[model samples]
Target: MSHFNDFNNPQVAALPGHLKQFIVDQHYEHYTPIDHAVWRYVMRQNYSYLKDVAYYPYIPGLTKAGLTIERIPDLQEMNNALAKIGWGAVTVDGFIPPAAFMEYQAYRVLVIAADIRQLKHIEYTPAPDIIHESAGHAPIIADKDYHEYLSYFGSIGAKAMFSAQDFELYEAIRALSILKEMPDADEEEIKKADELVTYRQENMGEPSEMALLSRLHWWTVEYGLIGTLDQPKIYGAGLLSSIGESSSCMNPEVEKLWYTIDALKYSYDITKPQPQLFVTPTFQNLINVLEEFANTMSFRRGGAYGLTKAVESKNTCTAVYSSGLQVSGTITEFKVDKHDNPYFIKTTGPTILAVDNKLLKGHGKDHHKDGFSSPVGKLKNADLPLEDLSADQLKDLGIIVGVQAKLDFESGVTVNGTVKNILSSTEKIQLITFTNCTVTDKKGHILFDPSWGGYDMAVGEKIVSVFCGAADKEAFEEIVYKSKTETHHADYDWKTRELHKLYQQVRNCRLKQGDYGFLGNVWQKLQHDHHDDWLCALEILEMLEHEHIEPALTAEIRQFLGQKATDEPELKKLISDGFYLIAHPVEQNLVF
Candidate 1:
């Protein structure tokens, strides 16, 4: 296996340092035989039921996505197949931050969770897993329209401005998911974590752009439906991966509504099955709705509204000026003019002045370690906008180099200094640095004092946009990559290990055609020792029933499964479904 920041796939290789930090080794050897059994069970169930209802053809997509109905997919193999379709796969421990997840999609890559769902939570698991990420998401990537919408959504989601409350809610969800996945997690502990999640969700106080976008993502990407509302087909990764919900979500009582901008108004509870789902007629409509919602985000609508979101976020974000200058920092405050346009903005700590997402030389965080404050808006006496004025135009206005310049803005901000240097891009003035500069607003608030060293005034007619993260993320060094919380890995007890051995013996029998007598032996062991376990018995029964040999042993195993189903309510559907698939094969019914 390759080490850190190494992947054979080109798409995976192209990831930046920050994203690479989230990648973890798949450790394929760690998956026990029981784990493979769980994966096999879920895939078989999904394929049998989903072939007719899934938007993408189920069987063919399996091969196309580098998956199998037989076992947990090899991550490297999945990447090789995904690469053919302009996509690649990488494994992360569990749930990653949403922004980073979207950014991965923007790069045409899939973020698969390394862990597989436990057998106990076979039907449905709250946490993300290999089944959900690889099987549920990859197959659908074969559709051109759907994949296009997916990548576009990623691009938009990457730029969405999220708030501090959004991060709180995200952490809460992550914690709860980790707790729920642990085999020995306490009920009381789970309840407390769940309550905290619900509380944070309810108290987020008006969702930010990223919060609202997450709703759209949940409704569409995770739980979305397609085709007519009367008979919408399953396409979402959440629905396709969940054996329980994949069937239940199709019930008429679940309430399928048309997908639209109103999806932003709907929120989701990760702990429960969705009571309602949104249906789109086509993948193109998904993009249309996303575009509509994006127009309302701070990334598209700048000035006061956008900057206010940045301040509320209390995290690193970027603000774009009309002059094409990018200011990346944690904005602490902004002052607006009488017309509600942001005329000045301030950052609390290290900041970067960038253009076109590239860091400007000598204008990095170290140079502005104390923070940055810059005045915006048009000059009071300039003919053209300050940003558009050429060198000749600026000199004509007496704003020449090596001269003491006094510039006044219509918004009543004033700058007095000796012109030291000017930075422009394609005739647009991006920044103006000065020595012994003093900046003050109309109300005599000293925004910048001469004692603070050289002043770099950002030039723009208006603040054009605002978004989450630094414009040049590599330059900003996104150290907030690895999550503080980790998904729990359960240590199987001796009894569980013995059960795994039985499962492995069954798999070897099917793959090698080793022995029919061993099936009888395994069945007897299951009846005397691991009597409560049904999956192992089911696998043994499958081989016996397929060969039409060991009739007496087959009947005995069948009786045990029937009785177990009756005793365990949760296993009823699973047992019955397995029986139906065995009797009615999707294809030649190979020995898996």
Candidate 2:
């Protein structure tokens, strides 16, 4: 409740004069002691588990980002570290829109949420927080390739568009997050917020272009893994940040599928633990699959295809069809025929246009709205009412008689009865034709006789549940997170922090004699596996060229430089200059 950044002020988000309104100050002082405690507990829990199991660069990236267990990180201080590695950090109140977030990523800025989850939600927070953003995402940004991959992915993702319905879901997410963050939010308010989320999800229907892009984002960035399925390691931010889900996701029972382009077909749920995780063999594989997936999207191509892609990408746009007709609006609904192919695009402007399976232009299906489920059981085959039908006439028209029918009552309750006849309304505004049915009370006495009459509500009869509809299948198989109580510690043998410090010293020309052996081992370890880390070791060798250096070590440096050096011109120059400095003791003015 402390007014950090004046969070309680209704106009705080509208503050002017900033480079971007979404970026906010960390407001470190606003976090109470309990908040700090939660940060520490979650950090310690996650770091201990991730130091060994997470992506190879995560621990080093954490240390290089200048983060510690001491307190929550100040974005400015974190930026100081990130700047060394060609990245930076920024803070936001909570979740930003998908496009805004991707745009930030494209610019190499981490969009961290300033708030921390309360103790009750320590294991997971549905909203973005310091733990999920800084602790979860920051550590891996230090790696050159992984960071570049993020930049490329973000650039492609920034072009995506979404339907108006998708925006509604996003707004619901923002609303729910704000409600959860409120210090005095009551249970009733929380339930209402949860229901809003559920309503949005239910209405989203099948995967649209934007939804598919989100699925890709979720699988790789949120809950992705790296390494072979038989021996997957945690790399995704979701696993890197969570205490419970991290350990749970790595269990053998969880389905660890090999990361492939087909991974795009899957959908995920944020409310539950993932039942399946896609594992890439390396960070480079993430880049490969992402590029492949991006190529398949229509938005990047621009056209009718691009139009769909634009809608998929979460942007509202004005586009001209081949007929030279232009339409501008947010896409609201989409539908496919029974074959599960896209057949129509509906906009909130109340416009519906038909597009073939390949997204080619087609005339609007005038009855497109009829495809949707309606209160009157989606009137089909005939526009006329089924009233004034005798028992024989009803049977002739394929109307099933003697079925239990449900009707909305005046008291907001639904009651069922056996159908006897059909009748039409005579009122000026005839609500709906009704079926005469026999209604019996609990005592088995018939309270009402069967008769045709005008009714105020639409009537529907319960039928056998059909589960094979195009959209009836579960979007994603439910995943369970089985929590563990055991505390974890960093596997000290890996020396993530030590390697980070050594690398920094090399960058700063501060390496000492005692560090040579460790540097030698690190160089050897990185030479075959990591081009970037190997280059850092070479830089350290270049810095070590001095008068006081031992002849044996100098010889070792020269030998490795000669045999393992690449044809890269900059590397060749660094090596040539390093040997020259070793030769001319007084001419040691060159920078490392």
Candidate 3:
């Protein structure tokens, strides 16, 4: 029987020159027959399944490292093999703190354990035994980039633990590590343990936090896989350690996305197999990712003041605000249908202020007359009918009908130009210009109807709508003129040109006469005719008259142009001419 030693002392002697040397110096014993058998069994089972599924780099790494399914590896021998690749494994008693772990890796030592659990205990070992620590984690340490990443993780982890604000994130990482080692632990028990950790931290003046940890662990360790577009593979320890996760993570259902540092830092899911895995095109790409992460997360530094404050404030305010809001009223009833839209918190409260559809100004004001009345008032009431009722009466009797104002802002920007001129205008528009748009109030509601026929309006327009509607045209025109006066015309012209190019592509594809293949052929011809200058082709088509084109060909072109004109009217017009040219053989011959 082995006793777990306390490896937390900062004054402990530095880890030995190499992991293997440390193991030998510490008098770490060799594995017993049972230990060797367990190692072989795990190695065989995991490798046999992983040989095909493991990252291509890992396949040779295991073989080149001489890690086989025969027996437990001798630490010295394994270290000798690893030494060629600038890595070695050191045996330890059990789990180590983040600081110690970092220190070991910072010195190029990969930590391992020297004992295996009994067969009966294998399924439920609360802590990592030798087999899990050494065989499961060691071989991959031989890879250079991976080894560096591990060292980086250690450094980051150690720094994170010292901060008061990052305590919750730290706990979440620890909890994940604990959970990974003890997969058999009940979900309720795990939740209870998390709660306990959170409680203890809060009592000690540490705010409980874990969402970021969950995201980091999920993307970097659990179910993480990386490779080039041509050859994607697994490198994450969680996937490397387990056969099933490795295979499942690469499935089509698990979406693969480009690896951006911001994406890794902010968003990731840990519960299910990841919906997306970042695919790095090369080892250099991995380095780039690390560099980006270091730069963005300030990984080289100890802690970020702004991030710390945000996390701390969010943690404290969420609990306080949720409690207060819940007391205002419980949602007694709700209704949502195909076209009716969903209604929230329909309840028998004090009748507040109610208004009819006419009160709302916009296109659909008369079509739908749905609204609500909430008795909550703040410092300012924006032109609402609040004068009739007294303060006391207002609290008891205020009703809001039609679409309620969920979020109100002073102004916004709109990109307005003819479809032909949009691209040129885009380049000319100032970056500061705000778009005036209204969003739908319901969940997943559209803020603005980009598909609306009159979406392209003047710039600097202040749009006011009940739901996805614009303010009056006169008001919009005034704002647009003001914005244009302040903005450079060249920038707007550049934007217009860019929009023109996009519209050209959509119009070309849409204005095709037949199937995709047939349309593609026609597009090829048009491209060839205009020396591949789509803009010139559109201009030529727009110049042709309907009488100059055949009816059948014109119909086909019109159908195609219809789809393209939605956002790119210039393309639509071009395709329309192409249809006419195709329909009228005499005109086509004359043009040719």
Candidate 4:
């Protein structure tokens, strides 16, 4: 692979002042008013929802980095804010090629687009626009560890270009990783895709290798994860750059998995909402993982074999067995076939099921019955000993059982049984219960209903609460009461007078722009509905009412408001309570 100089090392001088100045010189014309509004809307909505779910580091980093629900920041201004923590933003057009993207990261400059999609087009935008790239990713860039990990990622991508074997391995691992996460991904298809990747790597030239590397880049860097001990936070540019994905990753329904290099390299699925996310203990851990992989370039040649082993160990593939059946023909065209079929039975791992022919035609189920059909009579465990065979003979017998084998000895009596049952006669179910939990059967019908007071619930069963009516005082107390005293105030205390000043400033701004109809009549609605906090509403209205307001001006306004909101207690409370009073009508109108 081609080696590139690491731009993040201290030996590389800090960004030139002129380059920084050039980015600052870019005007508000670069971003349309609609873009600013979208930025404001998205930042506001996402921040509110993320307050409880986001990692503590992200919450403060966002605020401290000066991101607010008011405007799309100038690249230069954003850089200035991030420079405090040794990070900054760079402007780029939509998506960059993998090589180019890596080059940008190598420089410690995250490329953020400057445009934004309209509210209606937000979710379905075809590419990364300014709002998605900058707002979604820039704030987190301020974190030191995250920044370093990205730098390493760039280095890996750059080097992978040199070796065809390494590139193919990278692609196969990435494809497997992403496919495992996608909901629509077919297991058989995934197996096929992995097999194809392996085959191509073993046979292809540089062009094919490069193509696979590109695919890997798309899946991992643009759409991968940074798992930490506390949580699996998003680091991939795709997730970091998209508002929907950022919030979606934190939902309770999204399953979380422990972080391991092997799990990421061998079993990740990308096309669907991940059933599980791997969390890393720290950014250093992330760096360590990548670094270990990076140093193992020589060993990476055995990618297919390693993946097969991993798949087998994880039990990700199906198992099949058959007996007393003339199961001829090699396990031809097996999934994960590196080159030609190497004796289908000998091929271990997920593809092991392809060895037996009887199992291929729906062997075990009873076909005549409504459920399943079986062609052979059932085999009992006690019947096996009477056959008394050698160890190798018994081994073959085991394989037959796995394939759902039917035995026909001297007599014409036939017997069939599952290897799973033969190995273990009975299954055990463990039950766990929690206080105040409700229990439901496999069909979802309630088996045990907990009273309003509370009740015990069985393990391995679904529990859902039914609120028959408005909660009573006792119920409210049970839910809300805490053992320790809680402080219901901002972490940093602010003077009441300062908050009032901010409120007045915002209110005045809104009043000045109350006549303009842009932003879906935001100013007009604020005048009518938020008469009480008209001043603060007016401020927001004025800031957004103009068609060509400069980003710098917007940044100033946001900084002032952020400071006042932090310094003034009463004003902060008021702003927090009714920040959207004027924008409510606009929101309602837009929702429909």
Q: 87-137 in candidate 4: lDDT tens per residue?
A: 556654343434445545666666654445644444424444666666566
TM-score of 2: 0.52
Error of 2 at 59 (Å): 3.6
Return whichever of 2 and 4 wins on lDDT.
2
lDDT of predicted model 3: 0.39
Question: Could you estimate the TM-score for every candidate?
Answer: 0.97, 0.52, 0.40, 0.41
Question: How many residue pairs clash per model?
Answer: 0, 11, 50, 43
lDDT of candidate 2 over 1-592, digit per residue (tens): 2233423222222222221555666768766544554665566556555667887655466777767653578766687777778777767767676765675677777788888886567778787889898888888888788788887877666555556576678777777777776656788988997998888888886655567777877888888888788888887898888877888887877898988888877867677799899988888888888878776655434333554454553333433332212223344444333443332333442222211111112212232222211121122332333333344544554544456555432222333454544423331111122346443433444433456232222232111111100110011110111112111112323444455544544433432435543555555554555444323444545545643454565566567676544654444533453354335432112111
Candidate 1 lDDT (Cα, 0 to 1) = 0.88
Q: What does the lDDT read for residue 332 in candidate 1?
A: 93
Model 2 lDDT, residue 547, Cα: 31
Best of the candidates, lDDT:
1
TM-score of candidate 4 against the unseen true structure: 0.41
Winning candidate number (TM-score) = 1
lDDT at 340 for candidate 2?
36
